[model samples]
Target: MGDYDEDTAFLGQTGPYFWTTFFLLNTVYLSTGFNGLYMVFIGSAPTHHCLIPDVNLTREWKNAIIPVTIVDGVEVQTQCSRYKLDVVRNLSAQGFIPGRDVNLTNLELEKCLDGWSYSKEIYQSNIVTEWDLVCDDQWKVPFASSTLFVGYLFGSLISGQLSDRFGRKKVVFISLAAQCVSVLLQSFSHSWKMFCVMFLFVGASQISMYISAFVLGTELLSKTMRVLFTTLGAFLFYCIGYMTLPWIAYGIREWRTLLAVLSSTSVVYIPLWWLIPESPRWLITQGRVEEAEAIVRDAARKNKVEAPPVIFKESELHSLTPSRKYSMLDVLKNKNIRCITLMCLLLWMAINIGYFGLSLNTSNLSGDPFMNCFLSATTEVPAYVVSTWLLKKYPRRALLSIFLSLGGGLLLLIQFIPDTLQYVALALEMTGKFGFTMCFSIVYIYTAEIYPTVLRNVGIGMCSSAARIGSITAPYVIYLGTYNKVLPYILMGSLTIASSVVNFFLPETLNRDLPETVEQMQECQGLCHGFRKTKYVEDEGRRNQPIQREAKV
Candidate 1:
């Protein structure tokens, strides 16, 4: 056999087996979309103000107790503070009327000591209402969101090694089960701290399931199908899941009810363990030749094709070498690889921060939060379609830089837009999200192609870990917007632009052969070094020559 690609060519490329794998894996992809972004709804802060408990006051007096404060240069009722309730009650008992009979503006104000009341028009209950995560405790809202990414950070570090040691299928199911259970637990959380703790597990399991399923699908599909799955298939399913969140939240206004609905979706995947097969490619790497052959045979039978007598050559059927245990340190060992790693880390972090920063802040944008979320998720569908087509025509680095620049440029423009034209601001933000979505999709394919095969997992893991850092910080970025409306946009825009510049220094990997070793990777050139020549053309020719000779025999 030539390589894993040629060996798998025996199975039909787009028949029963291929389509079966596509639908099964897409199910997991869909689940990830919901689990990943449910926080945007669950942790949302609806319109709220300090609660005025029953102090035997009239309706007019109750309404007048909460003080109006200037937020973002607009006068709005303060969510955290109120005119001292006791003072207000005493004044009301003395026949003091608010606004007309008394100068209420001069009354002493204090933080909401009792609790807060939330508007039930949109969200009946969210974390903001459940735990009083507003005012002095407003910081807790974003911190609760950040806890999930902290779990993501830990998951990215450990899941890959676990999958490699155990198996992709095992890790995938375990993570899925963990995610479902954790989400269920999160719905019943008695306190903010408890919810955050459970969300950590939900975050960890969500990412782990996503990564394992991604690798498993990549290993099982054909090359063309693999590109399609990553660029269009899985990503589109994720978009579909994301788009569903707003409607789900719209129907189930309570955060607990929403979590229950989302967590229950995973139960559908439990039966998929029997339908989806393990990666035969991973099996070969573990020297389980018989197991690998058996899986391929089953695939052939399912595809209605004849199986080859043997799936691997003797040389290919060996356990992974000690060198395969490459660590993250190996990425930094070489100057060229180190440079590329740092650049990728920067790009990944910026893309994630911008993407999630916009996603999480959808509620704050003008227009209905549900509609804004629907529109944001809908924008990615076209973006993925456009990106899928562009991936075939353009070089990876150039496209990445161009998209990053576009995304950053749009975000930068948002800071200068007049707030009076809120629609204009919303349009610009959506456009920016489109650009970032394209970059997000492209970078995954680009990073994989750039790294050598041996260190690919490690490199990707490091990049994902960096992305978690961005995600953890993204909520805080949104929090900054509360201080100054344009600050979050400025920070995300600036960082994305900087990363776009860094993209120019990273190598292009359009038609180049995947480097099997680090030395081969070092010789590759970036946009600064023109374009690297393809090493695979002559290898394909040589491999074809052997087949030609065999035909003559």
Candidate 2:
């Protein structure tokens, strides 16, 4: 507090900010229904046995089976001869409470239901397939994600305008509660339609969390640490979700069980409300001078130092005059913003197209699907470690566009390899993974930094939703790969290349601030207009950097 810039003291951490944020993020992340584990959400039936409900089979088929129905038009009430009628009635009300009473055929050579039984079929999948998606029958998987993006899209539009309207701390607090309930309902949905409905609500909650919470990190850290640590979330929670999922994947055979297990973990966040500090920056912005200064004072006490002058307080709060409202249309009405929006959206779309597409395509990659996905994700841990340093020195647009091309290129080259070069293809996939992972982190920082703070969340949300558009298409590409292995790679590669060109029209954002409105964006070229270059020249220099060279190896 004593040595740092007056502007940044609000940004640096004082309480258990890091741990509290991690827990909040982990909550939404686990419910994201990522990978096959999330396969539970869309009701993809597990490849396992089911309890064959007792039904009145033809007399010949009925001998060994429990008769669920009778010819008298009365329900046989489950012909478990070993159990008393009263026992069956009480147990029936519970509806297959596993381990309670309906033991799955424990003793005799009893007939049982298979996975395709009505209950099992309904139990396995969510109603997302109804959207008539092109992704596996699991098209709903990405659609479910789209609902979330839609939620994010809306949140960004609303939260960016409204979060500041309220307070950063309040918006995040509200988002946390909203996200918890939305995800829980989605996980426990009784019908596919209901599930989709839940997805929509939960998606909003999710975006609110993403926008508000992500902003919290930036608000809590120093400028030096702001971009770096805030974006580090792109890596931190990602790795956690990536690693944490595999263990859950194997642990739960039932999709419902999987979702239940994941959704329940969010409950730990309830106590975080009492722990984490409110955003002082947000307080200052909303004209809560006294409260904002109080937060600063509390920090002074905790750090054992004196608070800064009253003039410093006036600077932050006075600048925050209540002004014109923001809306999604704000990005479109201005040329520079429109251009930046287009570029960021396309980049967001491409990265997810590659990221989630490749992720879902793990079914086609060699080895255990879960393990391969996990190992591939583990690659990002190191990618982010290197990215934190590299992003600062480089131009955001140039570096990201080149990484886009590189990611796209490796994907295309993998198609040229012979089946004899299975390992070669896998190696190429890793290279692409690393590039996209880096781009994924960069895009978030770059997008937020480029947009004005007024439309910051909306701009990022639009990009995130656009990313979902790519995401929606991604699963279908992989689903097709089920029939043609090379199809997804070829299509994904082409999309990436096409989107990379959009970066040319956009401004660079390297160590910069976002605009509040489109008017401000039109005033300047973009957030960082200092440097922009063609991907080729950038790649050449990157190739020379022996430590972090653009080599496939």
Candidate 3:
């Protein structure tokens, strides 16, 4: 990409082509947000208890058949254990009053042999109820959510190489189609196993679509627009999609119907193939010089600007075509690149853990589940907006550290807020969500910039794969709430705060030109940035003069 940016500067940044591409890609991102968190409603468990038969028991005996347990200092009917049904029936048959004649609590308890009764106050039916994933089977609930991330793990690994080999626009549409098909198939699942199987594909396709679109935008747009598009333009649309989820689920309580509705909306995005072009920069890197030139000329025409007779310098075009292909390992082979990659991996992991952990925990928050979800999604809007502004004004490392600390500190602060002031606790949680949302939005743009174009998607994919570990673990983190309501927040907050320190060890990427090659990666400069560049780097730099010059530019 030596002199590539300067050569294509004629294609104005704020033009019809940029807007159309930005709008279309953001629409895809919107769908990602919608589908990504559907589990919040679909997997939520409503109030349930062991089913008691009415054939032989009195109303008092039926009530006494279910055992009660104290959880979180509150007396609640136990969901799993129940009094021995035969014993309860015998007591009632003897014309004995349960409390006076016998101690109901003294009766031995057993697992729910028949089934469970679920309340329909909020959800009419969900996966939890449909598959009896409660009590003894409760682990399946979180496992179901984690299955999507498991899909994401594998998807992120391959999608980058696929997009790099095929094309971004192709991968974007292909992934969208796969996402829609998988989601539709998931809606028809007859059992938990079937649902999870489809869910894996859903997760894979969704993240592939997300990462491809992100990298496409990064390459297709100008540096000035890239920041805006990657941050507010991209995530705001995602937030818009996220905000719609609770309302959609609010109307359609059944998981199958809800998924069908969400998947059906993909039809509108089909025509974007003609509207969005392959990344001109990506094409140049592949040595498809004429094709890349034609796209830029078409963009210039759409912008009402006169096209230069020659867009790319002959020397630059020759240099753009690499002697050999690059792989994800290229990022790890260099000390500076490897250090940045490792830091980003930890950063992305922590961000995903905090982000998804809070998002999935919205259902368990104190309020109407729909309102809590909507509020959580809505918080991301301001977070993205503020982040978009902060990114322009501050160094990336500082902003990331501040945002992560702010988010994590607020979550930790909730432990001090008494349970009596629930609104206050909820507000604190939302504020914590706000902080993590900002971190979430920034990390995408940050990681994209940290890596060079040669390995941008692969680098992002690797970090994204590492990030799935956090998302995969997030459900279990929230699952900790079953034991103590505050455990999830405490753990998430602690991790967020600790991960922020890693940013201080990484280099600042604000206002810097994106590295076009591994040899062009920025030097690490921070308090603890002690990594030393290898000796072969000097020989490589002297051998590739144009790339070295571009790095300095």
TM-score of each model, paired residue for residue: 0.91, 0.69, 0.90
Q: Write the per-residue lDDT of candidate 2 for residues 312-429, one digit (tens) a residue.
A: 4343344455566676786776655666677777788889889877766654575565677676777778778777778769898788889899999999998789866777888889
Which window of 10 residues has the lowest lDDT sum in candidate 2? 544-553
Q: Candidate 1: where is the Cα deviation over 4 Å?
A: 58-60, 71-74, 313-325, 522-553
Per-candidate total of colliding backbone pairs: 0, 18, 0
Question: What C-alpha lDDT, on a 0 to 100 scale, does residue 230 get in candidate 1?
Answer: 80
Runs off by more than 4 Å, candidate 3: 284-293, 310-316, 323-340, 448-459, 511-553
Q: After superposition, how far is residue 254 of candidate 1 from its true place, in Å?
A: 1.2
Model 3 vs truth, CA RMSD: 3.7
The list of candidate 2 runs beyond 4 A from truth reads 1-37, 40-145, 308-317, 323-337, 418-423, 448-461, 509-553
Q: lDDT per model, in order?
A: 0.85, 0.60, 0.85
Q: Cα deviation of 230 in candidate 2 (Å)?
A: 1.7
- CA displacement after TM-score superposition, residue 1 of candidate 2 (Å): 17
**Whose TM-score is greatest here?**
1
- Worst 10-residue stretch by lDDT in candidate 1? 544-553
- Per-residue alpha-carbon lDDT of candidate 1 for residues 1-553, written as tens digits (9 for 90 to 100): 2388887788867778888898899888888888888878778888888877877786778888988877657999988788888888888888878998889878898987888788888888888887888877889988988999999998887888889989999999999999999999999999999999998999899888888888899898888678788889988998999998888888898889889988999999989999998998788878787888888888899989998776787865432455447887776666667778888899999999999999999988877999999999999999999999998899998999998999999999988888688899999899999999999899998998888887888898889889999999999999998888899999999999999998888777888777765545643344223213222224733521121211110
